[model samples]
Target: MELTRIGEAAGQRQTPEDLRRREDSKAANNMVTPQEAKERGITWRVAPPEPQVCQFCGQPIQPQGIVLQNMVFLWRPNVRCTCEKAVAYWQEYDRKQAEEKARKEDEERRRAMQSRIDRLLGNSGIKKRFQQRTFPNFRTDTPGRQKNYRVAKEYADNFAYHKAKGDGLYIEGTNGTGKTHLAAAIALQLISEGIPVICKTSSDLLLDVKKAFDNEGVTEAQVLDAYKKVDLLIIDDLGKEQCSDWSMSTLYSILNDRYEDMKPTIVTTNYNTDGLINALTPKGFDNTKIVAIISRLRETSTVMTMAWEDCRGK
Candidate 1:
């Protein structure tokens, strides 16, 4: 009966903390020494009879040494009543409970990570068609292609270093030279690693601002903040956009804010430095305006010219 109380007590509807407190209280009460028991006039036996019956289940309780506690030992120490069936049941129950808890925690973590990745990628402005671009699939056939690949890989690998210095890449080449591929690859990798990145064609960048200005539900400041404050901003097809005074001013403002804040930016272009200046600046507009944009673009970035054959036609 005494030995079986452990299982009986455990089966009670008490909270775990209450159960622990009850067990601790029981231990404190039963810790009387032989002399103390004698002094307290409590009847005691050093050795109890063998094979005591479990009061509830009728299983034989084995006698361990004289500990002056439970199991008909003239006092009480409620050992668990575990016949073979009960022992196996409790062990399996505990194992399953632990496994279920761990599984739930792992699933929660996975869901949270996926949510963050989605938000980052969605806000990154990477087009749906280029979503799957990655460094591993980029072909490096010729010398220039190989050099571009190496440099892009290094940039991505050491992104934290470049990001700190507001350093970026100026990729200039003809169409289908893997320029956009490498830039998209960089953005995808960083987003996967939980970094915030924005990749947009220069045209789309201006278009977004124009939409905000035209009261498309979002404010002009909000759109520009996203462009200026993101960890890395990639402006694709720089000189391809239809240039206007407003477009040049908007580009300069975003670039200037990012530059002053030490935020990194990547630019890809079909035109060389002088050609880009010419394309962005409208006819008869001050050369200094375009020169300022070029100056910052050149000074803040590592100029990489992709002179390889068109990758698309290949």
Candidate 2:
């Protein structure tokens, strides 16, 4: 009956005494126990004390021996197992890696688009034409000039006023002074702020206007447009442009347009108001129009006279 019970528990295949005898016989011959088997790096399973068989292979196992089968929890408790921990760690790492990759790609794309826009704006025909046709580097660094000036704070204040207010400036002094440098400095400031500016010597501008008139395809309107639309217009050596009938009219038109639109202009000249009037009247531009332009500019502008030696020469 004991054998039958053992056989029934072992699926009617083996008796408990038989199995014990076999295990005892094997132990006498120095056979390994289940725990010893596991210590010896062997795979095994242990049976319950109540005559239970191995759930996986249906073999009978000794109660005190280690049954080395994979342990699976129906519900997780406390810390995760090795396999679960490894998988979780890998999942989080991969998610963060993907996010980092996506962010880099977005940043690269934005930079590329910005570069394209800058290229388009910088390479426009209008911009190129202005560079080639207009005076180059006429404005020197103003902050440096302000520092060089003995009354730097005062000069800087005057410059800042014109820059912020978009007011016209009249810089009067003898030749070879720093009038042009100051004017250039203001122009640079405005340009850096994304304001469009045109800096030209009076002689060069007059010559260009004359050439534009003489040339078949060029019109006075084209020249006038470039001058009128700029935020700041700097005319250096103002009394030095070759005055003629067409040049005077062109000058009048530019000044009138700026005056009406409240655009700022900076004139650096060796001549005073009276000198300018005398020069303008000779070309049939009356004093009334000249006075109007000067008055408007004076009302909205600040004048700074530099009587020192030319810093350029120094």
The candidate that wins on lDDT is 1
Residue pairs that clash (backbone atoms under 3 angstroms), model 1? 70-76, 70-77
lDDT tens per residue, model 1, 1-314:
98689878778768989889998887666655445555666554554435567655787655333334332255344344677766776688789999999978856764554454344333568988898878999887778888999999999999989998999999999988999999999999987876777889999888878877677556778777778777788999998898888888889999988888988999999998889999999776776767887788789999999866666955
Deviation (Å) of 76 in candidate 1: 40
Itemize residue pairs with steric clashes in candidate 2: 44-68, 45-67, 46-67, 139-184
1-314 per-residue lDDT for model 2 (tens digits): 99988878788566788899988776444433445555666543333233345443454444333222432111111121235445576688789999999978856754543343233222111232233321233333465345434332243346445545656777777776666655665555544444565677777666665666676766766666667755567887776766665666677788788877777787877767788666655555456766666666667666666655565545
TM-score of each: 0.61, 0.47
lDDT of 1 at 125: 81
Q: Residue 18 deviation, candidate 2, in Å?
A: 99
Point out where model 2 deviates above 4 Å.
1-166, 214-218, 283-285, 309-312
RMSD for all candidates, in order, please.
Answer: 15.3, 27.1
Which stretches in model 1 have alpha-carbon errors above 4 Å?
1-122
